[model samples]
Target: MRYLPVLASVAALLATSGVAVASPAKIPVRVVLVTTFELGKDSGDIPGEFQNWVEKLPLSEELPAPGSYHEVLRYNPDLHVIGIVTGEGPAHMASAMTGLVLDPRFDLRKAYFILAGIGGIDPEFGSVGSAVWAPRVINGGLAHLIDPREIPSGWSDGFVPVQGDRPDLEPVPPLHSQWGDMGYTLNPGLVNWAYELTRSVELPDASSLQANRVRYKGFPKAQTPPAVMVGDTLSSETFWVGARMNRWAERWVKYWTENTGTFATTAEEDIAFMQALSAQAKAGRVDINRVLILRTASNYDMPPPTETAASLLKEEANETGFSGFVPSLDSAWRVGSVVVKELALHWEKYENETPENK
Candidate 1:
């Protein structure tokens, strides 16, 4: 409420209780669902059949395009709950999210942002389609605006000094010659909490599966709860080098970053956004004291060009571009549902206890 501006548009906004009867009262947590499409397609290029299935999900609102944040919220007035697309790379992700965060309407103090989408995983630990979590999200794309050559190669080198009063922004000296990694949620308790929530989700038919196969192998009873191997997520402004070999090389940087206290995964927006948020927290301009970023891997960085040569072949064994990877999409959709339901449950609990609101 403190951040709400007296703008004409906001004045016209009818203030609902900000509490939905379908949810628990005074939810201590605000969950945000963020997705991205590096390939610039709609609905994550989910297999057409799988798209149909995801659409049936009882989401509060659905958007027409991947990067169109405004459209997703058109039917849902609960601005606190929203979605964003990182637009081809990190700059777009930064620009769009900066707009949202700076907007007087967004209650940054109470909201937690979750960055969710597909990502490439380490072969031994994560196969395609298997979900990976980034407890330590690294902004691999960030560097001094002036010194382009001063690219931090690992987490220790990239520990940028955010401006303000908060101790969290202390100018951490670059211990290693790389970028710094930011921890979104270090609470091990919450990690286990999230794992238990989705581990039991039944795996769909394996005949059409692609990624996350080994984790859910033998058709085991959802033993992992849709787990994500948490690490540093790398960010790039440019489209991933489209050659498979090149992409593979770039991933080593991701691996090194993650191994050295940063989880390197790729997305366009999070690096700058995190820097801004850390600055704001230090300045007392906003209180993102409990922010959490949860993202699903949509693709691995540096995808092979042979797998997707531009305009070479329109249709393949699979038309939707997901190939046989429908189940991963299903897994993402299922996880989103659980998040929404849990938000509702929190709302319900809060309202039931409020004397006047009840």
Candidate 2:
């Protein structure tokens, strides 16, 4: 989708003006593309790719939000796509979402949301640039927090289950859920349909990414080039790393999903993001089942076998360590674009009707 040059320039103008354009932030739009924080305020970094991509699309409206983290938008009046940047992390996600969803300018009840972001991936399950469709989004932040050293000798990790008194129990609903619903399980049909649509799309790869993937010695899947897959996501405000935390992530997803969902990516905001969506659903603003999350692995959650977590910390902070950042953004947008495009092209079929998983 080619973007209008004016739309690209409008972002700069909005940043300088620190004001909302007179355009409507409220409208019955087709799609609400939700992206998390971009590194630079004015725009730079892989996280900003989604907005950059939107800039290239034909824009009909520029609804700027100087008071908010970012802006609401309009692309292809015909396609009716609007993008929302949920700031970053869980708190930012809730705040930004509340502002956007509750804003009176746009109607969200019929909008299809795609929460796309980069995540720390498990090399055991996927590689950098691999796009994952989350069937279940589990919260890793709101849990029993214990210092690993003080926990029972046999305890798996520092994070204990919120539902049970012990660390190793599956989550039982109506127990400790802050969100009335224990976990946000996306519509199976929507998730499967999304997976099927982009699973075959060829994602870009880089030599640095290849070298990084090669580090996953024993895991063949992580060694492959970027691809799309269906997997679950783990959301924690704590950006954790190490074999221990990685194991906790896997076990947490397993316990929450009852082995039905496999954890592939680790992110910081999906749980809170979805919870807000649930609220909007209750208010008859949006369909909870229409929400979809796509996470691309920007880097592995744990250090490779050859490197110790402590040893790799400094390196992981370097640009070379996150070689997948750019490619992952590419993969996410490329794969996610398919769904966004297909729906926009066939809005008559998808606007009011939820498509089957087929």
Candidate 3:
């Protein structure tokens, strides 16, 4: 489990200088860790404790060396860990991920990925700041624009067709529901560990946990707690502007009602990021069974932040009055803290119990 520091550092330096280093020594798990700017790009606002924990680890592995994929490398020869910050969005994620996967320098026998960041939650979940772990990833942006006049109101139209289209656009496959079978298993041990670790950090309790547990009555274990909420997530290709975000939110709400589904809105890029990893498994690139996506919501899209007036007194008065009306969206941070802790604890348990490692 130990790597030669001198050798590793020398290798890193050569790699950085456009010189290929000797092939990397095989490690335990080849991990591809990804995060987005949603949690603040600097990583300062991330729970102080979380930052400290990761900083203490020897994750300093060289990222993309010249022709390689990523930038920062927190490599630990003992743990066989290399944490890479794949850039933001699908284009960046896909390009960077593919680079790492295809790079012949590293051996990826036991591939594992953790796509962690913040996400926006549905209002039904009480506040916008809650964290969400998506069990299913759906492409909400693929739906077609259906005029009510063209389709009957009361019918459940599985597929809707588009009207006259311009030559510039390729016919969008009828906006139908496409599901990606990301094989990440719901590790009960990990879930429990996350919950306990989060609790240790003093985060708030899950408001919708119990309710969802009841809704999904067929849940295998009675002791296992339920997830936060049930909402469809919508993804967008462009940086979400205030105006467009508002319109899309309205559209998503209407679509949900019409389809009898409650979807929480997100962007389109995550789909590509996730799809790439899923493709690797399908293609036998690695032995990755599944991946867990932890996201934190950064801003409120619909019902944009009110326009600021020049009058200070008027603004103060308005802010005071609206204080009671606003739902704190910052709770997602707390939830994220807890989830991260749980994973750490679960890993500890597995490490202690595994016979080979022992």
Best candidate, TM-score: 2
Scored against the true structure, residue 317 in model 2 reaches a CA lDDT of 78
Show where candidate 3 strays beyond 4 Å.
Answer: 1-5, 8-24, 38-64, 67-70, 76-80, 105-109, 143-177, 180-201, 204-232, 241-261, 304-358
Q: List the residue pairs that clash in candidate 2.
A: 2-56, 3-56, 3-57, 26-105, 26-106, 27-105, 27-106
Best by lDDT: 2
- How good is model 1 by TM-score? 0.56
Candidate 1 local lDDT, 117-193, one digit each (tens): 55444332334445545554554443323232553443333223233222123344244233434323333444445
| lDDT value, residue 43 of candidate 2 | 39
Off by over 4 Å in 1: 1-29, 37-80, 142-189, 203-206, 210-231, 238-266, 283-289, 298-325, 348-358
What would the TM-scores of all predictions be? 0.56, 0.87, 0.57
- In candidate 1, how many Å is residue 175 off? 8.7
Sorted on lDDT, best first, the list reads 2, 3, 1
CA lDDT of every candidate: 0.43, 0.77, 0.43
